[model samples]
Target: MANQPQDDRTSKQQAIDDWLPITSSRNAKWWYSAFHNVTAMVGAGVLSLPYAMAELGWGPGIAILILSWVITLYTLWQMVEMHEMVPGKRFDRYHELGQYAFGEKLGLWIVVPQQLIVEVGVNIVYMVTGGKSLKKFHDTVCPSCTPIRSTYFIIIFASVHFVLSHLPNFNSISGVSLAAAVMSLSYSTIAWAASLRKGVKPDVDYSYKATTNTGVVFDFFSGLGEVAFAYAGHNVVLEIQATIPSTPDNPSKGPMWKGVVVAYIIVALCYFPVAIVGYYIFGNSVDDNILITLEKPTWLIAMANVFVVIHVIGSYQIFAMPVFDMLETFLVKKLHFRPSFFLRFVTRTTYVAFTMVVGICVPFFGSLLGFFGGFAFAPTTYFLPCIMWLAIHKPKRFSLSWIINWICIFLGVLLMILSPIGGLRSIIVSATKFGFFS
Candidate 1:
């Protein structure tokens, strides 16, 4: 028989119970998460790979391309598992998923570093890249204008970050995110148009120069970690999922999934062309900021400069918030005297100021992507999620392929650790191999 119309009620109730929104005044406008994801992912575009393409040629660059896709797809698979288990539940951090599946200790350990890299490491890179981009624009367009002092740029960048960070909540930020997207997209398009005009033929055979034999396997592992960090927008999923309204009938129920999909699509499109073109033009001579490949109209370069600078403010705000919040909650909560909101604001302001100064002071800070990719990327993106999935799903209870899965997990962890070390070494040793600027 048609059997009492089955039990749709249970699933419906589950969805409703799971729906949680991000606690911000801008509740009505919740799509900011998507914008942030897109921006964060694309932020990597400004870095040194274009030059790697110049060095390695298109074939190896294409290898890097494939590697990036594999890593992103694997992370995405883990995220899908995360969504299914929790459904609409809002998780404050990536490790929250781990906590749900495993326990608090493991979850915290895994997520803490992940959050730092995303918020702190990535943000620092953004600021540095933004600074470099602005400097280029200034030199090109306003050659006679006095070069921007680092202090002046830092103050301007930090002030903008403070103002934006204080906005009513994420909803307002989401709107700004859209504007950022348009600006970034326009910059990419213009840059592409200019790049195409150069009329460089793609080189099929870019010689493989293994600067150091770190072992092929180790190099691949290092490459894997770099790729994983490059594509990690996964934390957004946990938070966004938690923010979503869990109503059974609501089709757009999982905003995290929706946001990620939207963001990845935009990021992939924006990055691929730039990487491909940059490789073609520079032929192993590409700089970290791919725009350096373009000798374009002053207007285009100026627009790029302004947008990168503005985007840095939003990035730094996101980077510093959790750090400040964690400090206050863990330390200040027990302390007798609490600072007022304005005072707290000042505290955070001071902390960011310090980071800006330190970030600018260090010559090697720009290599953050490689550094964190080795140290933090694996545990968060691959190993932790796999562990969490096993914990949450309890695969043994369900008669799943435990042996194979665990093996994969171990290998993932090993590779994650190995990858960044190799990459970091490569960056440093590249100098020695080629003999002090070979």
Candidate 2:
């Protein structure tokens, strides 16, 4: 009789644990979680940094990157804190956090579309990038084997991606992410080293200007969008956190800050050198994709492109998993659909097809990155997380924490407003140079 109350508590806790995603034995170690964060954070975005640096100049571009990194890390921790606030309840995904902080309808509206844009936009970018890389490799190897369009390669890559996207959950893809991370690091090194070797050739004009008069303010904000895109990994932070091991005594987020530190350090190490070296070598003439700017030993460049293809392939899955979960859950709960393998196959394949078609229709790579970076990245990374923290903690009005949150909220709103305009201007300018289909 004395122990009955304790037994009842244990049973209730067990019931709650069963409902949570993090209670599984499949939960990952700190290193695996760190790797997932790194994989999601570092992708084709790094390739665009040199061009951003060229626009903003080195000092401002580097400053923006560092500041973005710091703020993103803070927001990521705020997310972890919010997850802990509800105690036994699981806020294992961004949408859930949004719904918890706000209401269901509004919260979903706030997060879902932006989340979709970030994930699907990236997959489209990956398809375009992969297609281009394959075309480059094919052209280098078989110059006489007739010209193959990038669109065709994109279709072929999408078929393979459709197959890979069927992997059921996040934990299943950790090994793939690990391999992708290594590939990213490898190609980043190759691009940096190749640029160093190429140096500043006589024909290429180089400028290290602090500011540009060409587009003036428009150019600055556009460059800021590019830099923001480079660090916009907050969309998947909660998903990565969900993969970390959890226990009653030691919540999943216990080692999350340490993991975040390790991952972002690796991200900065990989990003900064590539941006600086690529811009140092090519200056204002740097191509949006730095790998494209390399005109050296054919085989090495080809190898690097191949690595980029692989890295993006893995990255597409990492970002898409959360989107997949949300859609699947909605189908299961709201639509009363059974959570069967057939349902999973149908939904996942349909999502892949949708992204593929979008990739084909709007093949403008840099423009898409800029647009998504501004439209989605600002709100998701900066504004929502800070606001959620404020709402959940109810920090004192006009207090230090409150003041910081407000400042972050303002910055997020500013970026949200400016980035889209800048991105649109960039798209229009690029469209003038190239057609929509091009």
Candidate 3:
């Protein structure tokens, strides 16, 4: 061992030292990691793509979707590259990268909030989506029963979510991740098939309308935000990467990138067909949730809704595990608390409860999706990655790489500003018809 080259020894040392407690016994094959990435990227947000397609015409919508996918893939790769920048250190969390890129304060202030919004915000969406689907399913099955509000269903789902959230870490829930990925595909198929059924049916009025009510400007921003949200899995990229096995000869990220590419390809396959077909069928009439627009053959639609609810229930945890890990670490280190089972249960339960309340209170589905996607996903997925790459790599100023990074930064900033405005406007407009908590 002592006779080995310095470079080889350092590589081996880095591989061994990089093994985190959270990552212990959790190493996954490339395909399994790919499955996780697919599950993480494809969530309840995909249901809204048709609505987004409607806002931006199919031509522009498809263009944006493809563009978003390419940009997101690049940014994800950039993030991985950033992880490898510091030779002997590993960044297993999003904020860790942020702290390295800028400073601790900025990471705490900016990156921490981004992670919370991505994780907690998505959980809130899951509650809202699962609750709505459960209500719809129940109402379909028991027409004569008393009409139960979505809020009640949300509480019921949260009870289950609280239990699931207690899973110790991300890798502990690999089974859930696999099941969620399957569920996502099942529902996506049902949705696509339903869209075809709706399109071909007689007496169904549908035509492709690019923009309505909202002007071109508003619709463009709204559509952009929705697309951004649909691909906002960048927040969990590092956590997933950490689970891949590392070897001295061939490190973890080699397989991790393979998984990412494979996963994203599947994501594109699932996403594009649904968006195009749903828009073709419903056109401007497509509901924010394409599934909601699906009604006939009540059993199938109901089954698909059930699948969505199941998928989100699992997905809520995939995103939340990192946040939970971060919070527990903070409490244990800064607050001098023990890493006790009791503390874990209390924190996880409380976090789930908080998301449940917010999900129930703010039932603005499309608006919330847009808000998070635009305001949060744009920066986290696109803007920050470019900035971090430039900061770490120190690409020559005014070079092509530098210019591209600047352009990405501008686009992210543009989305951050415009997306929130559009999302808020949608919420306000939506509120006129259905008041808060309705």
> Model-by-model lDDT, in order?
0.56, 0.79, 0.79
Question: Which lDDT tens digits does candidate 3 get at residues 202-244?
Answer: 5433434444655666767788888888887898888887777
lDDT of 1: 0.56
Tell me the RMSD of model 3 versus the true structure. 3.7
**For each candidate, what TM-score against the reference?**
0.78, 0.90, 0.90
Residue-by-residue lDDT tens digits, candidate 1, 21-53? 233231332356567666555554534445545
Question: Which sequence of candidate numbers ranks them by lDDT, best first?
Answer: 3, 2, 1
**Model 2: residue 301 alpha-carbon error in angstroms:** 0.8
lDDT of 2 by residue, 207-274 (tens): 54335565757777888888778766788888788777655578778777677888888888888899
lDDT of residue 398 for candidate 2: 97
Each candidate: how many clashes? 15, 0, 0
Q: Is 1 or 2 the stronger prediction by TM-score?
A: 2
